[model samples]
Target: MLGEERASATRIRLLRDVGMLFESADVGWLLSERGAATSPSLDELYRGLVRALTDLAALPPCETDSGDLPASAYARVPDVAREVCDVLRVLLGRLAGAEAQAASSPASARAVVRALAAPLCVFAATHVQEQPWSSPESRSAASQLLEAAVRASGSVSVAEFLCGGTPSGEQPGALSAVLRLLRPQMTKESWKRNQATKFVFSWILTRVGRPWLADHLDHVFASSLLISDDYRTENKVLGVKCLQHIVVNVPAADLRQYNRAQVLYHALYNHLYTPEAQLVEVVLPCLLDLLSVLEKPCGSTEMTRRTNRYDQVLRLVLTHMEMEYKLALRRVYARNLAVFAHRMGVVMIRHLKRLERVIVGYLEVSDSPGEQSRLSILDVLEVVLQNTWPRVQSRLGALVRALLKLMCDVTADSGLCSPVAREELLDKATRCLLLLDRYSEGQIRA
Candidate 1:
């Protein structure tokens, strides 16, 4: 025991000395010395020093009454952080081999796994906020270490340790750390579409689907919103996958506890009008699925109210589509006109006219080939029209005229399509005009 104490003291002293050297070492000299070193013993000593430095770094910063640590101390942090991370990389590699060997021996494996959690969590919690150490590569490595530790432990404690607490509360630190680890693996650029889909689906089913995690649905949704377009697409796809899993495995009564429909609506709203092309393709099909589910008539007042939420969401979606079209068209105040038209359609259908008017109005104005925004709007309109057709005939004239003008504008743009396609659009427009002529004549009889 006495000898061990002495050795520990010697190691700490060596770490402090190296820390000081790291603070003052000339870059050129350090590089030259590092390259010239040929002795295996010296190399081992150098590695040992690095490990000690890492241990020292994992120690919490000393609390000083003088406020935050000095700038010089803070500046030394990244170097220490990198050294610790390097040591962890080596340790994790060694641990992986050990873990593989010990897999069959549950008791021994648990001990080995428990031993790893502290350092892995400490490294993650400490350096996560340190910008220099937060590079994608470093963050990914740290995440892998924590994930491995968690897998080996087969307990939630490691997740708590990394995330700081259960997902029930507003603990951003732990959440951020865990998410940082998970995000890289789930990002669109990191995985092919199919692989990304599978990865996120598995993660949701295995990790985020727990009751404890479900309570933090708001955080999950918020994080989904903040991720990049690539991540958002992956996240939405995962949400759909999880929804499918829940529908299949869990009873409807149990699934209803999740407010799955509400969650789906929020995700759909965010993605339906996103500018990313890949995301649009991925999300549109999911939205169609949701619409089909919601289209069934409600049998109870409570169910009816929930169905009304779907109505509100659909209205908001249409409004957004019009806004997108007006912006894309760059017409003089087209946005205001579109908004006015959407509101008019909403009010008319909700109160006075048949739903057919709304469909005609959307189809008319939303088909502009020159307007990328119109393409998406047209999709929404088509869905609504298909589902709510005969109800839309009263407003059909206004709707058809708007659609014809959009078609004309789109076909006029040379960059949008081949001349054959342009002629087809003109023919469609001519047919729309003929319909208007016939409709106007019928109005004289009325």
Candidate 2:
């Protein structure tokens, strides 16, 4: 009877302390968001929170047969091992948006971020590793904090929640490669869902230091397609955004010999043809960005590989144009092709010769492709001329005939198409015809 009373008394004290700590945290949070009404300093709240976590970390491991509120978890009790795990679940959950308050308390915010990150890593290292704390509760709570960081915080905050600071531009640290989280099958009860894990883990890998992505690009790319959610579109967006961020932001030195920029390029390039409009929209800029940053002085191998990728981009655009519903996306894709031709010059144009039939097919009177696709094709042709007239340009007779045929069709009195579209087609064709010297010799009046 005495033991029962003592246990009850300790539980009451724990309940009292938990209530007071939470109440103080709430007041601090309220003050942080709104002007003070006798609320405690955020710094003080953080300190109290930190002390509670450390105290809990020092608790005895929870045992299977013990009551739900184990005496071992109660500080100074038999084991006191579960104390840290208990404190983590309650505090970390409440601390969900707590990092947002740090800005209002700048004097303490940085320190608080650091305190949250470094200790949390130590805590994770204990519970998240292969041989971690024996307490299942601690492991579960640690996973909760990780996933919460991804769901609740921005990238920088998430970075601080793991690495104590945003990743620097310096060369990758020896620890940059992630092995622990590379499990083929993450124990879901012990891990975040694949999308969150992939998204957040990819972000974590990038911030580990420069060139960290060079090693894990495949896994990251695969993660984006591992779709099994209602938010699959959103997941792909985040995943592609992450890919673009690393490609554009990796330090030049880090990418020097990283031949796999080609892989990153193709990985995102293939997504451009997906039926999902939103996914296609997100992929265009990333593909463009990848093209923009395909570093110059590329070796023969990379250069040849990139040339094929460029050709593939054009081919995809041309193929998509045949489908009427895809005209809007086709316009964007062709514009990107123009940019590619401008940069790659004659080499890219040579490959495009094979697609002349397709371009003329659009201008043919039988098929009334929209003004957007027609004008965009002409725009691309204009760019090709501006880059360089193919001294060896093939199919001259056929090319001039197509131009003449398109101009005549647009100017025909039977004109069933929009006056605006006709004007655009005529204007674009006139410009394109003027670029070809054969137009003068062939009497093709644009």
Candidate 3:
């Protein structure tokens, strides 16, 4: 009887504290009282107020006429929501405190975090979908809550939720309720709809909803295909970026489950070299990095062949680089040629004859006084000589004379050159002289 009386007292105290914390005047005054207090006890009290309010925010939706609330009460809702988010933001840190205080194992801390997550997500989603407050602050709060839920539930469940589906073990009704709450605010302009689809793709690559993703691969691919040409550049670029993330971060076994891995590789490769596509600067480096990862030699045993799907992808990437380089030389501005050469050195080395002729053609017509253009051409020649020295040396006589004449012009007309241009010319001249002497000696020895 005494224990039962103590429990009743505790419940009554909790209810009283919740009512005080949720009062419009108290919440408004608290927001106004910032920077006024430094006492530890006051700080503790403030934290307790936040905890009570968070509990209130987490309550399952009840059928109450929010219109009946006073104007002041409605104004306080955004403030209360913001404060609750601030408190939950510190959850991971507080888990350490829970770990220290508990007599039992620390695993309960994870359960506490998990328990807080669903309620926090629902609360934030409600405010996110609220038409009255659609500002950046509200969106940020919603993103934070959803991101927290993702971290807590693992990537797969989060992906499933984003795609209007639920994980296998979760209660269907509960999931539907959450989705219904968020649906009102999740509008997508036609242009933005495809970009938003990347979140679903990312979730799948993270292994969050692998089975669902696999089952719907045709749908996803078809949607990507339907993306108009203008948007295709950005969407395809994003798609490749996501694929690289999945390829490196996800386990090989997980990636192999989707028979479309090769199809994705081909899709990325095709877009990268498509004649009209404008390649974003970052895409090329990322593609090369993915190739490097995929081409890493396997173990020496007979069962461990170096060639696999990854190798096949690397070969396609190299071929794409080669094609793009040739096309750039034939069609792109001379100024942009250097970037292609530097980026496609691995490809240039394999097709030195075609590349050498292209470089020569660019140098022949580079009679303009623009320092940037001249330096860019020289930069390509420098990379070619450095990486493909033997092949370059075989025809060094013609290339050497071309570089020497350009260097002489730059030195004689130093007034037209920037310091950067002069430095590049001097460096290329010195390297070329050294290579010419070496090649001459090798010819005599032969």
Candidate 4:
């Protein structure tokens, strides 16, 4: 009935009628011998579900830039699609629930789930590509329905289906096919499509477990790299996040196999060269996590062997910080610098020359209205002092001068800062000064 040549509204009404009938019927009764004569057979209900899904999938692309569809048609498309999805969700939920309890055996339940995988995956992918037509509500319904369908399959996870079908190779899963369909849409010109594609990939990544992800690392890794390499900063940040997920999900041995870890390392490292503070901010933490997994201690000489990757990243960050003049980027670098310093520990002394210049340069200027960069730099200095006080003592004179100058500068701009923030800076500076005095044997006072 849904596949007939009828208006979208008529088809939706038919779907709603089917949904209402199912919603009113109890699953156990529907599957019971007594109600079996009155209620639709499971096979008949499954066919109706497929038809409704087909009606949904047959909607024209709602792209504004594409087809010359009337504006009225475009406006009506999402409403019609959302309604059909709502009905399909209800119908599928009832059918799946009934099938789980009604199946003669576990194999039968698994067979039904496997049969539904292709259609469900296609439908979910349609909703996930939500920018042009599907509403958020419809997309959410699709997710719930997909989950329900998988849960009914018992013992087989969505991840298992995605990684490979059924272990016996009965049929190839939809994940690879979905990726292929979405990849062409991830172009620079079609940003909405690109965004939608990423969302779909994110959904897949979330459902997949480590064992599954490890087997299909290339698919996940390649998609992340593609997004990270996009010209857009937002996509780049999301791509980094996806990579972070992969780092945590895939085991170290697999990540290091065929130098996959190094490839990821350089990808993130290349992102740091972009001047966008937002992208840089996300890349740093992801890099930190990836580094932990990629690099490991070999033996008793672990301490002596320098973490060259960390040092390389630190050097580049310090270089950028030294030359950075923008308040936002400086603030970002300063904030992250403290984190790196803490992680580096005494390894921070490796970049003392650049670090000193950055510290002095950052302190010389006033970040009015909040002085967040100065506050973060103060934190970095504190970490430096705590970890490398012996090396820091030699540079105490310049550091003390910078600290005193910052204190006087903060006082000079008293109106720029709230009383609370001003006091905090003063307190932090005083602590740094006191540390210098203590470490330098009153050299700061001198």
Q: Rate the local accuracy (lDDT) of all candidates.
A: 0.44, 0.52, 0.48, 0.72
lDDT per residue, candidate 2, 393-428, as tens digits? 555667678888877767775455677777887887
TM-scores of the models, in the order given: 0.43, 0.49, 0.47, 0.76
lDDT of 4 by residue, 168-268 (tens): 44555556655555556555455343224566677777676655567668777887887788777877898888898899888898888999899999999
Off by over 4 Å in 1: 1-79, 93-109, 118-133, 136-207, 210-307, 315-370, 415-446
Q: What lDDT tens digits, residue by residue, belong to model 3 across residues 385-423? A: 666666655776677677777777767876755766677
> What tens-digit string does per-residue lDDT give for candidate 1 at 254-359?
4345565556556666765556444444444454445445444333333333325435544654454444443333222222233323422332234224233333
Query: Which pairs, if any, clash in model 4?
Result: none
Q: By TM-score, who's the top model here?
A: 4
Which order, best to worst by lDDT?
4, 2, 3, 1
- What value does the lDDT take at residue 76 in candidate 4? 46
lDDT of 2 at 79: 21
Error of 1 at 220 (Å): 7.3
Residue 342 CA error for candidate 1 (Å)? 18
Best by lDDT, which number? 4
